[model samples]
Target: MIQLNTKRQFVYFIAVVLVIILGLASRKYSNFLPTFLAENAGDTLWAMMVYFGFRLLFVGKRILTAVSLSFLFSFGIEFSQLYQADWINQLRATILGALILGKGFLLVDLIRYTVGIVLAAFLDKLSLKYNN
Candidate 1:
């Protein structure tokens, strides 16, 4: 189980990196993508990456653990945008902070996050079944 988990963690890490690349590309190359996808893919991939990150950290835990934690963490970050103090705003101004914390809130983002997390969890379950 430990060896299996180590392998799983490696896979999840790769997944996270891929998601990050895709997310950045979705922004950088938006002109090449479809309108809807260009508008939504970055946030969706971000949420998916978050789910994969949780899975990577909690390799032995159930899928629901990662799903639930991803939802909480993603939603928390979205809602945190409602608070705009100088310190946090300064952090949000930086490239890394803007990527992680976002600059504004959008109800659509909640929906995007929901879709991303569900899709990630579904894929994770499929991978588990295939491996088993």
Candidate 2:
């Protein structure tokens, strides 16, 4: 197994948790952010999904694993909004907030996640040229 250091594992852990929280908050704060961002929060969160997915995949796994987790994390957040909490949803009201707090979940977000994955994968390939 690939053993990540405490800090690395923590970073990954926090990333997942934070996104989940943001996803939940975004739904509650439906009135918090811009219409454009609010409408496409799925895409923005998908980018985070993309980033982490790529990061994990870079470490070596079947592409499906990263893709599955990416969709799971993103879609999971979209699903959580049905509960409607206060503090969590409050995050959707700000600029970055809307990015975190989604407006609402939709099947379309899955498409965005797919696009984000492709985009991230492309960026990952591009990064290889310079990151070394």
Candidate 3:
């Protein structure tokens, strides 16, 4: 595999923080958004945040590594919703838990995740290109 350049951890950290803010704003201000955006923006931003989080954590890794890990994690959380065991459900009931684990599974969320990860990777590449 081709070696990709390392990313600036601080930049990725800022990206993650900004994405989290946007995700919260998307939910808080959903009424002002168009129907589709209101419904999908939060999830999209959530996935983007996940991608940035991975990038931040794996600073020396290729962008594909971050993208793949983000997808695996995001999809894993979504799929975990299908298992309704009491222990996990209880955990999901809490605010932080719900934010991370989610309450239920929706197929559409997978597509939203894909879009988010792809967009984040694209943006990261552009930033890298300009930085170099």
Candidate 1 per-residue lDDT, tens place, 1-132, comes to 334348889999889999999999999999999999999999999999999999988999999999999999999999999999999999999999999999999999999999999999999999999998
**RMSD values, in order shown:** 2.7, 7.8, 4.7
What is the C-alpha lDDT profile of model 2 across 15-93, one tens digit per residue? 6566556655666675897876577664755556545644653445544566567667666766765656687677766
What clash pairs does model 2 have?
25-88, 25-89, 26-101, 26-102, 29-89, 32-93
Off by over 4 Å in 1: 1-5
Give the residue spans of candidate 3 off by over 4 A. Answer: 1-7
Q: TM-score-based ranking, best first?
A: 1, 3, 2
Whole-model lDDT, model 1:
0.95
Cα lDDT of model 3 by residue, 1-132, tens digit:
324344488788889989999999998899999999999998899999999999888988999999999999999999999999999999999988998899999999999999999999999999999998
Cα RMSD, model 3: 4.7
**Alpha-carbon runs more than 4 Å astray in model 2:** 1-45, 48-58, 118-132
- By TM-score, who's the top model here? 1
lDDT against true structure, model 3? 0.92
Candidate 3 accuracy as TM-score:
0.93
Evaluate model 2: give its TM-score: 0.48
